[model samples]
Target: MQNPPLNEILIGDCREVMKTLPENYISACITDPPYNYEFIGHKWDNSEIQRRIEKVSGKGNKTLVKNIPYGSGLAGGVRNKKWYQRNRHNILDYEKWCFEWGEQLFRICKPGATVLVFNSTRTVAHVQVSLENAGFYARDMLVYKRSSGIPKGVNIKQQLEKKGYEQPEKWDGWHSCLRNEWEAICVLQKPLSNNYLETLLEYGTGLFYAKEQFGGFQSNILEGIQRDKTEDFNVHCTVKPISLMRKLVEIFVPRLENSILIDPFTGSGTTLLAAKELGINYVGVEIVPDYLEIINKRLDGISGLQGMLPLSE
Candidate 1:
């Protein structure tokens, strides 16, 4: 099938949805897929958590709830009451799902197309191996880092309470040990007879926007872009930061002049929005209805997307 409407959101499983598209249709894919665990939540909803926080501090204080979700580290493990059991159908089948979807992804991607899959330390190896076995070449393994200036939260109130202070000040909430970022971007490229430059030409349409900002070293490992909840989707699964997505597009899948970006696991449509800002075409498939709504709202206020058509057509 021809790809869905450009700039629109398709609500469905990516594995099933991507199969409908034509081969070699996408120039590249920038994805932050679900981590196979249901606990990760749909798209990082921390409003309830923030509300609790604000209640703890005073309703009028914005600073008190600022870091409620992103905190000093990745949020706690996703808690699904039925996760470990086999009674109900769960995406937690981990390796099986990884390999199955990895194969599907391999099939859909164009030859020499680049894919950047983001994951945490725990499942990084599984993702890497699955992709490799499915025939994608692993080009690089890079960490997404945060600045050392930021504090962590491994131990805040306990230390302060031990010292006889009733409560550790908010700044004290910053963990002394800088929190290592939770996600890693594993870059892969499909094998092709054509040269790498040809592949770059096909994908680098919007790369110019981030090239000069990289300070000479074209390292794939990125750092310090915090996910702002205010600008983020409230879905349970953690969404990747838009700045990080922009850099990923520029560095890996440079925008192709005539082609559209495709994101199968388009959580909250971060990839689509990034494509919009870069003046590229895009198709996003989201499995969750709430996330699709979030994507629409995000696209609505973007001035550049004023006349763009939704991919759901």
Candidate 2:
């Protein structure tokens, strides 16, 4: 099949759109799907807090409150009500949905294509199970550590104090949950042929660029700060930093001149932008029309990004 013109964002359900493309056309996939954690806060929420802190401190504000009480003070009423209805299903149902999409993803990728999926720590195991059940080989897991994170859960010490009970000094450290500082990215691959070199020659997939990884070797842990909402970039709530996305793309498609990357859940087009910056072809599928608008604006702002066209085009 002739390579289709990519570098465009398709506004529709990914499962439906992926079916229209030719089989084994995608070289690699790097995407971040919903973790089924209900209505969890994203990078935009955190950035708002940082903006407020800077406002009070004037500049160079390093200190941040250890904990912020839920519903007490925060933007959007301390929680994302929009996400509440979407993630009401239980874990079992969520995993089943994961399997449905995983099967489709496996069908579209080449023989030895790579797939990198980001999930919350709680649901990483389920995601792995879904992918493995869909016939993708389980590779090593990658960890992305963030420099800052907001801790959530009930404060036992504070509750006891409010109830007029004298708690021991050692109880100061007690809480229902710990601060989340990292997220898990499950690495997976389609089964390759016995001879890797022959597989690469036939399918144009099957190897990782060892030398292109950060610091020579590709460690499981990738450390980076989150992307803040700047004048040119901020559109989605859970936007990842371009630097991190670029690294993942580079590792997946070392020979970018002939490869095409697919982002199934292209929120605000961060992955697409990364592909454009690296001078490669890409296809992004977004369900929300609002997000598609954001993707268009972002792509338009990027200089020298060829094949820039509207969704209708």
Candidate 3:
């Protein structure tokens, strides 16, 4: 098959857009999918938690309030009560949902292609099950550790005292949950030929670049600061740092000149930008139009490649 269009962001459902591409065309996939937290509050609504945030952070602190939803007017818990309610389906159902897309990804990827998928710790097991069920072999899990993380949950004793109820003194240290400081990235791969050298020569996959480390040596744990928006690019809420993405891409696509990376859930095109920085080809698909615009604006600032690759008829 002719080379599928590269260095472009297609606006559509990933599953449908992937159908148009040639089979076994993608060399690697690096993506951040939604955690399915079901955040329902609008940006404008000012809840008690927002008011508290404003009070503590002072008024006009746009960074704290922008695009974040505060449910139950309280800070704590991995997700708000509403989020749990919205995603009330059984765990099996959620795994099935993952399978629907994982199956499509498995079909489009080249044999021995590497897949790096970001998932919350809470749901990573389900994602792993789904990917394995879709025929991808589970390789290793990388932990992307961030320096900063929001602490969730409230002090049970303090809440009781505020409500005029007696509580045990030993409960002072108890809380609902611990602060989340890391995200799990599942590394998976398609089946490869028996001979590793032959597989790499035939499919341009089945190998990882260990020498291309971001910090001298590659470890399962990746440490980096979470980067926000800059003057040139609008940042998505859950944007992975460009440095982190670049390192992962380098490891996945060692021969950057010949490989084409694909990001099915390209929120703001960070993976695409990384590919461009490395002078590698890439195709991204974002379901949201607003995010597509943001991606285009981000790509516009990049002078690497011009215009989209024309899709084959």
- CA-lDDT, candidates in order: 0.63, 0.73, 0.73
Q: Write the per-residue lDDT of candidate 1 for residues 1-313, one digit (tens) a residue.
A: 5434666777787777777776666667778765544323333334544454656575564432323333322233444554334313333445556677677777866777777888765577777887888888887787887544233335766667678886477546565365554567787777763665565455332222234554676655676677756564455445667887777766655444555678877877777877887767788987766676788888776655233322211
| Candidate 3 stretches greater than 4 Å from native | 1-3, 39-90, 212-216, 226-229, 232-235, 304-313
Q: What C-alpha lDDT, on a 0 to 100 scale, does residue 114 get in candidate 3?
A: 92
RMSD of 3: 6.2
Q: What TM-score fits each model?
A: 0.66, 0.77, 0.79
Q: Write the per-residue lDDT of candidate 2 for residues 139-224, one digit (tens) a residue.
A: 88999998877666668888788888875455798997899989899999988877678668777778876673346777778886
Q: How many residue pairs clash in each candidate at the backbone level?
A: 22, 0, 2
Q: Which lDDT value does model 2 have at 76?
A: 24
The pairs that clash in candidate 2 are none
Candidate 3 to truth, TM = 0.79
Those runs of model 2 whose alpha carbons end farther than 4 Å from true positions after fitting are 1-5, 39-89, 168-170, 212-215, 225-228, 303-313
lDDT of 1: 0.63
